[model samples]
Target: MDALEARVHRQLERMRELADRMAAVRVRETSADGVVTAVVDGNGALVDLELSDGVAELSPTDFEQTLVSTAASAARRAFAERGALVTGFNEEAAEDG
Candidate 1:
């Protein structure tokens, strides 16, 4: 391959690796009182949730709020992680270029 073609090939490989890493991303967050736990995937979709018996003490509104907040926190963390991965990939690609 020509030099430019070789560079393109390398970048394609890096992109594939980045996609794999992003796909594997997962983040978990729990409420302060341990009543609620949430897990989110790279796309910030809630993949799992856990509730402790302590949740029984919460009113329906409170429980709903806590569950939403916990899931939001986990999704935010997942987004940050995915951003960092992309940033690192970009930095490496820049260096290569």
Candidate 2:
């Protein structure tokens, strides 16, 4: 292949790799008491949630706060991970070009 075509192919491959990496990204966080766990994908969408038996012992307000805080933590982690991955990819791509 020509040099230009090879470069284009490499760029396309890098883009595909980035997409795969982002798709595989997930962040999980549990509450301090370990009563609630939240899982979020790279897009910050809640993919799973777990509630331990101990959660039932919490007051209504505490239960709500735990769930909300846990989910927010997970989402924040996912966003941070996604940002780092994208930033690294961009740096690599810039170096390559």
Candidate 3:
């Protein structure tokens, strides 16, 4: 490989490192009315979940599933947004370097 290519690759590696460092963060999310809450990692893994007592009182067969799904989706969305920020930070850093 040539010098320029090698340098670019190094820069990209740095960018990836930055992304990885920021990626393992845990994020918490909740439903619109704060009834359901979920914790997710930067990889969008659902690490923890919590339901309000009020929600438990409702007692619908599918309600729990639906709330969990909703919370997961919200966490995923938050992760994606954070990932985008990381990507942008990498790009800017690369440019500056």
Candidate 4:
């Protein structure tokens, strides 16, 4: 209702925009054998996967599970990094405040 609240709201909106941009990013993780790699979006959506014959040779169930887990892990890391960026932005805002 007041000016200060309005200012805070604007800042939060800016932060959200930054978060959205950060979430749109992409990151990758590779399997131990380097035979499989997973790509995930900033929000942890599995976008693409690269698997070599070595990886394909594995039993289908286990190979698929590993790929899925690795993709999830990559997504988790991307989120963690995004969180860190948000924390950094908040810290900067606090200092400015």
Candidate 5:
């Protein structure tokens, strides 16, 4: 293969690896009061939701807020993790190039 073709192939392979790694990432977050927990994937999709006994004592509005905030936190964390992975890949590619 030509040098340019080989370089393109290598970059495609690296991108595939990055996609796989990102898909495998999950971030878990809990509310400050420990009443709510949420899990989100690298794409910021909710994967799981959990509540503790303390949640039962919260008012309806508080409970709703807790769930929203907890899930938001988890989603943020997941995206941050995704960003880190992309950053690492870019740094490595830059160094290699």
Candidate 6:
């Protein structure tokens, strides 16, 4: 292959590797009171949630607020991680170019 073709192939391989790494990313966050915990994927999609028995004591409104906030925090963390991965990939590609 020509130099340009080789470079393109390398970049495509890097992108696929990035996609695989991103797919494996996950972030977990827990509420301050430890009543709720959430896990989110790289795309900020909730993958799992956990609630402690302490949640039983919370009012419906409080419980809802806690769950939502915890999940949001987890999603935010996941997004941040994803951004870091992308940033690193871009930096590597720039160096290669």
Highest TM-score scorer: 2
RMSD of each: 1.1, 1.1, 4.0, 3.2, 1.5, 1.1
Clashes of each: 0, 0, 0, 0, 0, 0
**Full-model lDDT, candidate 2:** 0.93
Q: Candidate 2: TM-score?
A: 0.95
For each candidate in turn, the TM-score is 0.93, 0.95, 0.60, 0.75, 0.87, 0.93
Clashing pairs in 5: none
Return the top candidate by lDDT.
Answer: 1
Query: Which scores better on TM-score, 4 or 5?
Result: 5
Give one digit per residue, the lDDT tens place, for model 2 in 6-78. Answer: 9899989989999999999999999999999999999989999999999879999999999999999999999
Instruction: Please give, for residues 1-97, the per-residue lDDT of candidate 6 as tens digits.
Output: 6999999999999999999999999999999999999998998888998999999899999999999999999888888888999999999999997
List the candidate 5 regions with Cα displacement exceeding 4 Å.
Answer: none
Compose the digit string of candidate 4's lDDT tens values, residues 1-97.
6988998888988778887879677889998877779998878888898988797578989898888788888989888888877788888888868
Instruction: Give the Å shift of residue 74 in candidate 3.
Output: 2.7
> lDDT tens string, model 3, 1-97?
6988988887788768777767766777777666678887777778787877768665575567667776678677767877777778768776867
Stretches off by above 4 angstroms in model 2 are none
Tens digits of per-residue lDDT for model 1, 1-97: 5999989999999999999999999999999999999999999999998999999899999999999999999998999999999999999988997
- Candidate 4 regions with alpha-carbon error over 4 angstroms: 1-17
- Model 1: CA > 4 A from native: none
Please give the lDDT score at residue 64 for candidate 1. Answer: 95
